[model samples]
Target: MTSIGGAEMVDWNLAVATATRLVRPGPEVGRDEARAIVAELREHARSAEEHVRGYTRMFGEDADGAAAPHDTPVLVVDRPGWVRANVAGFRAVLTPLLEKMQERRSALPGGAVLGAVGGKVTGVELGMLLSFLATRVLGQYETFAPPSFDLPAGTSAGRLLLVAPNIVHVERELDVDPHDFRLWVCLHEETHRTQFTAVPWLRDHLESEIHAFLAETDVDPSTLLERLHEAGQSMTGGRASGEDGEGSAAESRSLVEVVQTPAQREILGRLTAVMSLLEGHADYVMDGVGPEVVPSVGEIREKFQQRRAKGAGRLDQALRRLLGLDAKLRQYRDGERFVRHVVDRVGMAGFNRVWTSPNTLPTKVEIAKPADWIARVHGDAGN
Candidate 1:
């Protein structure tokens, strides 16, 4: 890897090899196949590079003649260590749970589709596949311009970050087994990409809500400064605020945290509700698809529930902490129940009709009170 202005460029050949290996776990690409894929990827990379360059020429520099973009540079990686770490972490933590989830499919409304894909994958290869899948899903939305994954330069867009390091850290901590982890993560992230793509309005809705929340957020600089000063003093004196005087600095820090404003809270609530619905629907789809495709569907579903019960990362909690929007646990249950109810009452065809329009889709209230939703659908059908 060569560094330019603190950004490292990744070798595309290595990336393709890693990705190919992950997608087709046991066999290595033959010399001819490797050459062909690398050639194709190079062409793809060239196009991506050109796109990024054009974007830079138009929007890269600010009025001050300095690079104004805040996003990390998009570099091609042939063998990024972080990518491997992420794949490994996801496998370690998520695979066993998925296996367990497969066992309990009967109890779950839609647990039949666990481990739906049965191919072997190396960690690096998995990341490449995920990145590719994410691109496809995000491409469905007209508003979302795909990032230049092949480029070696950053863009002005800060919202969509390819924070490979952060991703690796989170995946590692989650500690799920790799194969199952990759499947779930692929489904999860791909679901997000699909939802944003399928619901064009939702992209703006989420972005606007996030901006609105961020705009209203007020951090107490004074409090932050005081805390820093106190920490410095304690470090020098070896005596903090506690009676023991040997306690850690955290002990002396204020327990109070930043509180959300009413407006922020409202936005957060709406965001969480939508996210929960999205996740729940994905879970439903997975459950539906898994049993038919994967042999271990029942075991995986059981494992997934056990992981959740053991205080494993809740989709809502992680999203809330990351975006300041909490997807309530009940929201998933409600959303899943709603989907199942809709499917049961009207069949998949009727359920699909609701997605014909955002307005037709069930509201937060409808999600909570599914009977009203059923009645509305029936009444509409009668009309």
Candidate 2:
């Protein structure tokens, strides 16, 4: 890690500014209606926390018996606020990668000059990426948010964000009950919050994995230049280096997939396994909540799965693929199946062992083979 002029590799402030400017406005509502929506979302989040804890058996015998030591704060935000929060998260978690990029830049002949211009260019690119995501995400538990007043009582625990407009927009699009939809969304998000807050070491373990991944980046100056050139060509309607005909498999790969080294790919596999487990666990918890809690739970899941399968418009779909979001979609399905299989084979208590420590978590191969994870973690006792 190296610093040139004591400045960051990506201009984060500019990233926020660019994203805010480009992001689409949320569905319109009256001021009072907006306030009501925000308030209800907040209430739903709190209530969902209780339901998630009870169903997942995360806290204790009684949902209230053993509360999470640091209850993460919930923030109901619009698109711009979500962008800002994610940019903060990106800056915090990506520090090592940024420093690595800076080191690469410094080794070049005109390194300082490259850093100055590259920072803003990278900022704009990041901003464009965030703008695309801001509208689509319904809720996110920002695992890497920097410590700030955003956390309750100044605790460094992460914050749960409910994107009010996205929630409203999706419910309307799906023709679902807003109340049930909102609560359903909260249930998924609250499960993530509980996973981190209740388990304690989860967040730090994830952060370490991310840092480890970034620290292994070995992109040289020439490779960086080549990637930038390829990116420029793609942006200007030119085919990428090896892109051949329409619907080529290579064309669907994201920049993330294209640039990884073998070492980075191995680390990414581990990270993917962890993320899959977390996300799958959340989906399992949400779906497992009975109809008494979310009356339209079945309808919501059905419609949402259809919507996810259909995805957005062509250009949006292309962007999603470019951003590696399509892989994220796979994680949900695969991870959920993995969780479902394990829970059926063993039980909730046996499944709980996955959260005991990092070692107990599934490997990438084991994620696809629940039997392997069970054998490794629980042995035949689970049988």
| Candidate with best lDDT | 2
Q: What stretches of model 2 exceed 4 Å from their correct place?
A: 1-7, 61-70, 152-156, 221-252
Extract clashing residue pairs from model 2. none
Candidate maximizing TM-score: 2
Q: What C-alpha lDDT does candidate 2 achieve relative to the native structure?
A: 0.81
Total clashing residue pairs per candidate?
Answer: 39, 0
TM-score of each: 0.45, 0.91
RMSD of 1: 19.4
